[model samples]
Target: MSPYNALIGGVTATLLLGFAAQAQSDTLADIRERDVLSVGIKNDYPPYGYLDENNEIVGFEIELVRYIANELLGSPDKVELIPVVASNRIELLNSGRIDLIMATLGVTEERAQVIDFTEHYVSAAGASVLARQEARFDQWEQLEGQNVCGIQGAYYNRTLTDHYGIRLVNFTALPEAYRALQDNRCVAMVFDDMTLRQKLGEPGWEGYKIAVEPYEYLPMAGGVRKGDEAFLDAVNAAIVKAEGEDRLIDWEGEYDMPPSDHIAARAEAARAVAE
Candidate 1:
C-alpha cells in the first residue's frame, strides 16, 4: 500500500477506535439520558427471535430486551429493536450502530476476547446433526466422513470439523444452510438444538431428523462492546432482577419454552455472578 494510503487507513483506524471507546464509556448514561435502548436481535430464527405475521419482531429474546430497557430507561417502550443475524451483530455493536445484543449469541472463548458477555440468561444443549431419518448416525464418529451443512462464524464449526474430522460447507445465513441441506449438497446439517427442533416441525423439512446431537451445551447471554463497566453493570443487574421477579418464567409460557435454572440462581445476589 502507498504511504499516503497507509496513513489514511491508520487515521481511520484511530478514529474508529476512539468512537468505539466513547461508545462504551458512556453507554449506560447515554441510554438513560436518551431514554432509548438499541438492541440487535434475530428476526429469522423462530421461538428465540423472529418476525411475527404482522412483521413485528417478536420472540423470547425480544421480551428480554424490553425487560433490560425497562430496567435502564424506566419503560420498555424506550427500546428500539434492530434485526440482526449471526454474521454482523457484533460488528454493528462495535461500530456504534447498536447498543447491545440480545440475540442467541452463545458464550465462547474466541468471542469473549472481543465482546463482554453478561451472566448467561439462558442455557442451551440441543446441538444435533439433521439428516434423513433413514440415514444412520449410530455412532457419533460416523460423521467424520460426511459433508455437513453449518453456519459460518459458529463457535462449534471448528469442533465439528477439526475435532470430528467432518467436511463442513458453511453458510452465512440459516436459510442458505437449509437450502444446502435440502439440495443434498451436504448429507446432514449441524446446528443448535432448539433451532433444529423448530425446523423439524416446519413444512418441507420432512424425512429429516437429528442424526447427531450437538457436542456442546452453551450458555446464551447478552453481548456488549468491550470496556464500559458501568453499562455492563446495569445490564447485568437488570438480568438478575428480571430472573428474580419470575419474569423469565413468565416469558417461558409466552414463548412456549422452559425456564433456565442457571439464570434463576444468579438473580438473588452478586456472588461472583453476572460478570
Candidate 2:
C-alpha cells in the first residue's frame, strides 16, 4: 500500500480509539450532570430484582442500586431502573441505553471482554433442579437422559447439555419454563438455585422440591461498559460502603433470602478496609 493511504488509515483508527475512550470515561460525569443513575435490572427474578405484589419493582438488587444512587446522586429516587434480561443486558449497556447493569449479572471471563464488572457482591448458587417431591433423582448425573426445563441464554445451559447429558427444553423467560414444568412437559426444571429455592416456598409449589442441588456457585457483580473506570470506581466504592454498614445483610432479611457466608465475609472485609 502507498504511504499516503497507510497514513490516512492510521489517523482514522487513532481518532476512533480516542472517541471510544472519551465515551467510557465520561459516564460518571454525565450521570452527575443529568442527576440520574440509569441501571439495568431484572424485574422477574425474585429476591434480586422482581415485581412485588403491587406490581412495583422491588428486590435486593433494586435496593442496592438505589443505595448506590443515593451515594452518588444524593437520593435513591434519582435513578432510572430499566428492565433487562440475561441475553440483552450487556447489549443494552454497550449501546448506552443503561449506565450500569445490576441484573443478577454473574462475572465470567467471556463477558469481561465486552464489559467491566464491579467488585462481586453476591456468590450466586448455580443450576439446581426442581422436581416433584416424590421424584427420586437427587444428583445431576442421575438426570442425564431426562428433559429439563430451562431458560434460553442461561450460562450453564451448554454445560448441562454437554457435560451432564440433559436435554433442555429452553424458554425465553422464567414463567414459561416454570409453567412448562407444572404442565409436566419436562421431568424437571433447572435454573439458578436461589430462584428455584424461592419458588419452592411460594404458594402452589408445595408438591415440589429441589431434586438436585447446584453443582457450582458463581460470583455476581454489577456491569458497566468497558473502560468506564471512573463510573466503575464510584459504584465499587458505594458497594463497599453499603457492605461495611451491613446493608446487604439487612436486605437479605427483608427479601426473605437465606443468609450467605460470602456476604458476611465481604461485610467484614469492607469494615476492615474502612478502619
Candidate 3:
C-alpha cells in the first residue's frame, strides 16, 4: 500500500479502537468483572454516611447500597465503600472511580446533565438555622446582618446570603460549621434538618433547637454515571423494592427517627409505578 493509504488505514483502526473502549466503559459487565460495586459516600455526614463506633462505615445510605448489592449480586458483602467529599462525588462517578454515589446527593438539572439519578430515596429541604433557645427568625428577611454558618457547598448559600441578606461563613464540613455555632462564632449554623436533629439529640446538644421550619423541599437520589441504562435500571429496581417494603424507612429507624409522612407518601407513589 502507498504511504498515504497506510496512514488512512491507521487512522481508521484507531477510531475503531476508541469506539470499542467507549463501549466497554459504558456497560455494567465491567462492574461484575471487578467483583465489587464501588460506592461513593460522605464519611462525615451523620445519619446518612459516617464511621461507626466499631470503625466500620455505617449509615442510611450505606445500608441502602448494601441492599442494592445484595439484590443485584446475591450478597451485600460485594460492595466496597469509598469515602468522598462534596467536591469530588461527581468527578469520582464520571471518572469511574466508583460505580455509584450513595451520598446525600440532591437531584438538580445541572447535575442531571452529567450523571443519572435513581428514583429519590430520601427527600431533603433547604438548610435552616439552629438556635440556642426560644429566639428565632420567622422569615428569611429577619436574618439580616446576623452571622450564619453552613457547610461550604450547601444548597442554601444563595438564598441565605443573597436573598436573605445574611453574612454567611462556610466550613469544609458539618462538624466544623456546627462547632462555629457552638463557639458563638455565628448566631446559627445551617445543615440538613435530619442531621441537625440527630446532633441536637446528642449528649452535648442541650441548648440548640431548630430555629425555623424547613423552607423548601428537595428530593435526594443516588448518582450514577450517565448512559448506563442496565445499571441504572438495576439500581432503580432495587430502590423501588426497598421503598415498597419500607426498607429505607426501617433502615433509618435503626439510627434515627422513621421516615416522615411525606417520605412515606412519596415512597408509596414510587412503589405503585414500579410494580
Which candidate comes out best when scored by lDDT?
Answer: 2
The Cα local distance difference test for each model comes to 0.77, 0.86, 0.75
* Candidate 2: pairs in clash: none
| lDDT tens digits, residue span 187-275, model 3 | 88777777677778888888778787677777789987767889999998898888888887787688685356666886788778877
Q: By TM-score, who's the top model here? A: 3
Model 3 Cα shift for residue 127 (angstroms): 1.6
All candidates' TM-scores? Answer: 0.65, 0.71, 0.71
The model with the greater TM-score, 1 or 3, is 3
Q: What is the clash count for each candidate, in the order shown?
A: 4, 0, 0
Instruction: Please give the lDDT score at residue 225 for candidate 3.
Output: 70
Runs off by more than 4 Å, candidate 3: 1-26, 33-35, 132-158, 165-192, 203-208, 257-262
Name the lDDT value of residue 264 in candidate 2. Answer: 98
lDDT of 1 by residue, 141-201 (tens): 8989788898887766777788889899999999999999999999888887667877887
- Model 2 regions more than 4 Å off: 1-22, 129-191, 202-213
Candidates' RMSD to native? 7.1, 8.5, 10.1
Decreasing lDDT order of the candidates: 2, 1, 3
